[model samples]
Target: MWPYVAGFIGGLLAAGMAAAGESYWRRRRRTKWIPQELQRFFRVKDSSRLQVLQKSFPRHMAPDAKRGLDQWLAEQGLAARLVGVPITESFINTTGLSALMAPQGESWYQVSSVEYESFDVGGDAPMECPKHALWLLDGGDAKLALFWTYGTHRVGCNWVERLRIEAGFVMDSPGSGLADQVLARLEEAVHSGHAYRGQVLSLGGEDDYRGNASGVTVHRLRPVARQEIILPEPTLALLERNVVRFAEQRPRLRKFGMSTRKGLLFYGPPGTGKTHSIHYLINVLQGHTTLLITAEQIGSITEYMTLARLLEPCLVVIEDVDLIARRRDESGVGEQCLLNRLLNEMDGLRPDSAITFVLTTNRPDALEAALAARPGRIDQAIEFPLPDAAGREQLIKLYASGASIAPEVVASAVRQTEAVSASFIKELMRRAVQFHLECRPDAESAIILQNDVDQAIEEMLWSGGPLNRALLGAGEGREQP
Candidate 1:
């Protein structure tokens, strides 16, 4: 009886193992079989009775559009079926060119399934939903369907979608009618807005200039207020009139037969207010799209110009323009090529086009003559000179707004900071405050003393020697005229 029981137990264990093996094999077979099933569905031969509709979109948006499109189809009261195919590594490796091609005159192709997690409202664990290929059931009436797959184009690994509208014989001109409908939907989606609004977009990758056309890297920037900037009254007014006013009165300018397109150049010593003024201008023109191109991105200037044209009523801000637009003789062939492209884009723009180019440079003398010499290429060349005594006083007050600094102390500091840039005044105020806070950490409010301001200025000037003073816009070692 013991031997019989042992044998019976062993047989039961063997049967259980066999069932598990069978289940595993069945799953593997189904994994391989799905693409084939989709391919077969794609090759239906009754073209005379079927109408096809197709459209493609970027891969990023395909998955997002699925739910909305599915609901719309259901609301239309059509029998719709949606299937997702997973693009497993095994499938990609084994699939051949013949397997990917659609039947003659048909737009269907096998796509890999991707799985996304769906969450329940009760904070339950996520459930996996597989989506690979989309199918619209053909039951007498026309059906709308779409599928997502990798694009065949050489423009990098982008997602492509093929949308279809299949109707049985009742519709005449399915292509145009369906295309119009698709366009209308697309227009609505675009008008709804994009995720990159009010964000800075920089060129991405080395191939950006080589036609790889990968999208830009976005950066969110904090807006700088006008009062936060310290510039000469005339300089501020000039920018307000040309840059801000021009953008606002663009339509009016065109009405008066005036060219709305303008170019501005800001040149001065490093650490001056050129960049700060730009920040202020960006804030002032809040609604307008602004594209910023640094010295490193000069290679993709042409692409930036194209984008500026597309995003009209835009500002193209190029910092350190002298880096690329250097004196032609001093520049290499490549630099010259970039400079020419820059010149051509500026010159080619329509007079009435609502686009402005604001370029800044520290070394104005290094810039190409063609860029600055031409009247229309740069309508205004504003110099961001070292701040005057009054400007320095204002800057000190601005940066020290929260601190307890008397006006007399600021006036004295301004006298000592003659020929200093706005930046130096800012640093001077910062250091003075730091000394005050460190000494009076337990005080209700810190009062910045005259001694603190004097000490900070003395440290900056003497610590780094004359080179530091000159760099800080103190104009050290210059002949006192």
Candidate 2:
């Protein structure tokens, strides 16, 4: 009797739900109110029709996309396996002709037995990427699909990396957008590297990884506080205003229809704190992504700009800009080509882009002045001259790290180090401390007197000769006229 009563109640509940579902459908009410699981019971059409969809991604993004697909498929309970096939090469030889690869339409290669490569994903261990992978999902009455992840490498062509999805799904239902769903997930994978939004990245040459196209190195730089950088008050303020403060006001700048994209030129002798100033700027703009490029990496400017545009609110630092961005009259033909590209990249950025370029160089005269004089190319020019007397004293104290030094000796040393770089002060203090240590190794503290500093200067300037002095930035400490 109890069983009969339960059955009768279940029948009534099902009937009532079916009637309500029909009414909701006819009225077109917001269907989201209905729980997906509850609706699944009523709609039970098994997958039947077969279809395929495919799309290509940038070569650099292929490895990342595969990892993303792996995680997603695992969550969906799909079974996958890699199918490694031997790459084949067919070469035609003639009596007078040398053996050559068949064609893009037909060519083969194998550095190793397999083409699986390991990519560094900014983790303790690298992720393994296979040449080809096939995934199968047999969800009986729900999902019947196969996914393929692979890349295509043509000898001279740029086309690479493709994701293909083939599925047999419930045909033409009100929902069941399988193709769109997979693509949406793939899009997530392709643009998910560099760890986080605000990271320091550099484009490495194609020397390390065998097959990976974009050798992106994640830089974990220590953040520097303002106190650490010893710059003139005005110069420091200019830096803060141009980069840090501007980055902070990106939202307001965009709202007012002003171009947040800007460029900065830093020209001075080497070791004058240009690089150190950039480090401080990095600290202030911790929320922005920074990309560092050496002059040798100018060939990858197109890739770097793409990244800058993708990662907005970005900082691009090109060290020794004069190497490529030289005055047209002084630069060679090759240098001129690169200079044009660099200028074009700067000028082409949208006014709304929050990208800042900080270019450093030792030779200001070498610069055609194209970057600094141009309106859109460079927003501001900041000179990193040799430190003044006051800065020299601070640097000495800073590197000395609370050593026992008298005020008179400090003043005298500062005078002797005139027209030298901040680096010179740093090196001088190091040598002075060494001399003091040699004389008083077991002393309670480092007591660097006038004689100790004088001896160190003599070794650097006079004993070492002109070349050594020039390299060390130990300018001749002649008394003023």
Per-residue lDDT of 377 in model 1: 94
Each candidate: how many clashes? Answer: 8, 1
Model 1 / residue 342 / CA error / Å: 1.8
lDDT of 1 by residue, 128-211 (tens): 223345554444433333443333333333322222222222235333343355445643443332433344556544233322
Candidate 2 achieves a global lDDT of: 0.67
Please list the residue runs of candidate 2 whose C-alpha ends up more than 4 Å from where it truly belongs after superposition: 1-52, 62-67, 79-118, 121-131, 141-179, 192-196, 206-214, 439-445, 475-481
Ten-residue stretch with the least lDDT total in model 1 = 119-128
Candidate 1: residue 166 lDDT (0-100)? 24
Models 1 onward score TM values of: 0.74, 0.73
